[model samples]
Target: MPTVLVIEDEPGMAAYLKTELQFEDYSVLLAYDGLEGLQVYEDNAQVDVILLDWMLPKMDGLGVLRRIRQTDDVPIIMMTARDYVSDKVAGLDYGADDYITKPFKMEELLARIRVVLRRGHERATYQVNDIQLDTKAHSAVKNGTFIQLSQREYTLLLTLIKNVNQVVSRDELLDQVWGTDYTGGTNILDVYIRHLREKIDDDDSDVIQTVRGIGYTMRTAGNDN
Candidate 1:
């Protein structure tokens, strides 16, 4: 799972960011002040991106950026009210990867997050046997034939493909795809698995096989695992 560390001192904005990022299936860590933010970053070794406010207590965002740049190259995005061109230039020169002004639309922020992610990370494509996915574009294909997939279907396929030959338990799928607080029954998972099968399975056999009592596994041709 990808993680986002949000450092905004404003109670309202920080809560909003945490909620929206979590809704998008991202693991989110929140810090209300610059010092706390630095502590949070140091505690979590796998922070993918940071959304930081310009003015913060204990220390400023640029200070935090400089501190982090001394060792790590992780992407940092400034989300603040400093819209002056000089301010943006200074932030970028000081090692902030991206800058977004305050009162920003959530969609724009999300898109910016994705763009930085694509640049900071490796290629987004994942290929397993016949199935292939370009995660950056949110597109998937089977043997070069485009296969239409819903958001849920794409996530489900990506999870299984990442695990490849291993069994993904029912609890795991439910937690990752449907969120941890899902109140629905396991039948929902079966339903989506059927939907995926219809789109990607070969005519002769199922690409994703049941693991009997354990969970489910995706096995391509010849492997038989």
Candidate 2:
């Protein structure tokens, strides 16, 4: 059974969720406040999904979501009474995998949970040397040690690692990572490349190689193509 970490403040609602979710055969964990919830997540690495409330104490749901996304890409569903489009967009843009307004039926919530779980099962991992990137978690591991990454860094690294030795042009990376609607120079890309190098590269060698006139490529073997 998949484990779910629920971060809801109300006692009655939280208990109710625990009961219903248990009936559906899911292992459940609960935290009444955002801070406590985040701690629970950090303690339990096996948690497969999160049901985060909007108006949590100590820290709000969005704050918790942002914090978690910086290190792990765990599937998070924002549960709130606010059903506004902007609210939903903001939640998603901040790294929420799904959003459901409050007062929703248990069946619908369970269905959404199933969706995220299925997607989570589809997650993959890529490796080059000691570095590894998990598709679902959006996290990197170097020499078996966790390397926390920002969302942008994870996306950029994923793009290169997936293609391995194949050169990924700057325009392609810009469009894929920054989106087509972005109106900015490639300076940000270069800056992030530097950032990635600082974090992922060793003193003697680098996994990401610049293609000079083109873009970048990740090398698993020799420096030369």
Candidate 3:
């Protein structure tokens, strides 16, 4: 059975979610605050998904998300009352797999959770040439050497590698890697791409190619010809 960790502060809401998840035959773990939620996540290795609330007593959802992304890439669905696009983007950019607004239908939430879980099972790791990424382990290895990456860098590289040889647009990259709510200029993508190149491509062999106004494409050595 898939284990779900619900990190919500409200007693009523938490109870409601627990009951519904139980009805669906999902094993549910409940935590009323962000701190407790984090602790629960650390202690329990079986947690497959997390339904995180944006507002909490001890720590907010974003803080919790950041901390978790430091080590785990488990599918997270962020629940928030804030409906603004900016808020959604912030959650996505912070590494949330999905976002749900408050006052949502339980059925819809369940459906989204199913989709995220399915996707997680479908693509746990990706490999091209000598580069490898283990999404479950949240680690990247290149030529038998572990590549140390910041959270954003890891997310960025994963997105690129998923698409492989296809040209991933700047807008798409921003939306997927930085979140669509990103208000800053697109130069940030360039910066991160440069960082990835420096780390992943030691010989300056153009593993990641800039497509001028379009975006970028990740090319493996085997596909370069």
User: Number of the top candidate by lDDT?
Assistant: 3
Error of 3 at 220 (Å): 23
Task: List ranges where model 1 is wrong by over 4 Å.
Answer: 121-225
Instruction: Give the candidates in order of TM-score, highest first.
Output: 2, 3, 1
C-alpha-based local distance difference test score of model 1: 0.84
| Per-residue accuracy of model 2 over 91-196 as CA lDDT, tens digit each | 9999999999989999999999999988775567789888998866656999989987776787789889878889999998887666555699888999999999
lDDT of 1 by residue, 103-168 (tens): 999999999999988888444677888889875455789888999887678778988987888899
Off by over 4 Å in 2: 121-128, 133-225
Model 3, 1-225: lDDT tens digits are 999999999999999999999999999999999889977986675788999999988888998898777556899999999898998999999999999999999999999999998988444778877899987866799999999987678878988898998999999988776554569998999999999999998675778888888999998777753
How many backbone overlaps does candidate 2 show?
A: 0
lDDT of 1 at 123: 45
- Give residue 200's error in model 1 in angstroms: 49
Which candidate leads the pack in TM-score?
2
Cα lDDT for residue 146, candidate 2: 92
Please give the RMSD of candidate 1 to the true structure: 12.4
Candidate 3 shows a clash count of 0
